[model samples]
Target: MKTYYIKNALRVLLGLFMTVAGIGHLTFQREEFLAQVPRWLPTDPAFMDFVVLSSGIVEITLGLLMIILVKHQAKVGLALAVFYILIFPGNISQYVNEIDAFGLDTDRKRLIRLFFQPVLILWALWSTGGWKYFLSKVKK
Candidate 1:
């Protein structure tokens, strides 16, 4: 029961963070954020715009759903962890393609930050119970 409380608290905090970030993308014209989109992506600019908008909505919605669906919270959390991992390439690409987008002037700092992506991924995984599933899967 104590462990469950800790997990719930962590999930709630993560969900709130995601919700705020999603809303931030929608309410603010973050050219820096969108500019990181790889040029090779084939979608038209308008379509990409909608995609960003929709991604934000989806993140926000999933955050809320994870909070309300206590019985399935772990499943939802695992899904969210996967989502974070999936999006990491973009974060890496952004840092690699242009450090300026992140308002950083030094490649050294940027590279250092890149190393922390896995930490964030792990945190998401821990929050979502992915680590538990991962261990079980590994033991099988």
Candidate 2:
């Protein structure tokens, strides 16, 4: 029971974090996030803006679902983990291109930041039992 509560708390915290990040994507930190967009992508500013905005919307939705859809948390967690995976390239781009944003000013810092992506993915899965859910499905 204690473990369950702890997981719930962590899930809620992750949701809040993602919500704020999504807001940052849409608002205050928009420019900072723009730096993370892979340079290989089209340079058209409008298209880039669309990518950021759409991803922000997806983040917001996933965050809210992670919080409110407790009964479906496993699915929500899976979705959020997938989302984290999807955005991993952005983090990679930030590191590879040596683009500074969110205080990852140095190459080492950006490189270290890359490792946290897997942690976030694990956190999402573990907090909502998505890891077990997925494993069970795979075993069947």
Candidate 3:
């Protein structure tokens, strides 16, 4: 079905996006990711680096699972959604602290960026039929 193809395409695209972002976390854009880390977290630079590195690894793994685990799409979707939720505070801190990264030099831009996380969560759930699956389970 056309809808199924579209959902698959979106999932693949999201996976690619997350994979590239994870690589950035580990490599060229490390400092930018560091900026996104919440100030409330420990200020030890080494600890921040470790956090970034570990989160990057998680992102890469989740991205790959989203793409390759078709039969477990709903489960993958739920996991990705939870991952998005887990990282949301970083986005919130970025906006609240007025720390600019990834060329989001303006507060308005950063605030707008904050909204994308929820969209990603919803996208994961919808694309993989996770929401429908959850609803079905609830009805049982």
Candidate 4:
């Protein structure tokens, strides 16, 4: 069916996006990206390393899960949405602390990234059937 193909297409697109992002985070220890986290953030070097590795692994896993497995796809999508929400505070901290340690030079660019945060969240929710699931639960 057309609908089925569309759904798969959307999932694949999202998966590819995440996969590439994770890979970048893993491979590019770019100073620009590292500068975003301030020195006073109480982030231990080991912990930060673990975070980087785990985040990449999680992203890769989720992409594979969404693309390779046919069943429980919606649940996997929901989990990915939750993961996006969980990482939101990091984005907030960057904005609130004015940590331009990242290459973002202007407040405008930081604010723009903040806007993008929710868009990604909403996209994940919609892509994963969270909205439909919520509606079904509400109807019941």
Deviation from native of the Cα of residue 132 in model 1, angstroms: 2.3
The model with the greatest TM-score is: 2
Clash count per candidate: 0, 0, 0, 1
Worst 10 contiguous positions by lDDT, candidate 2: 34-43
Give lDDT tens digits, candidate 1, residues 62-131: 6786678777766777778777776666666666766466565567766776777677666667766867
Better of 2 and 4 by TM-score: 2
Q: Which is the winner by TM-score between candidate 1 and candidate 2?
A: 2
Deviation from native of the Cα of residue 129 in model 2, angstroms: 0.4
- lDDT ranking of the models: 2, 3, 1, 4
lDDT of 4 at 61: 85
TM-score per candidate, chains pooled: 0.78, 0.97, 0.95, 0.78
Off by over 4 Å in 3: none
How far out, in Å, is residue 44 in model 1?
3.6
The whole-model C-alpha lDDT of candidate 1 against the native structure comes to 0.70
RMSD to the true structure for each prediction, in A, is 2.7, 0.8, 1.2, 2.9
Q: Tens digit of lDDT per residue, candidate 2, span 1-140?
A: 99989999999999999999899899998998898888889979998888888898998999999999999999999999999998899899998889999999999999999999999999999999999999999999
For model 3, residues 77-127, the per-residue Cα lDDT tens digits are: 888898999989999999999998999999999999998999999999988
Question: Cα deviation of 41 in candidate 1 (Å)?
Answer: 1.1
lDDT of each: 0.70, 0.93, 0.90, 0.69
lDDT of 2: 0.93
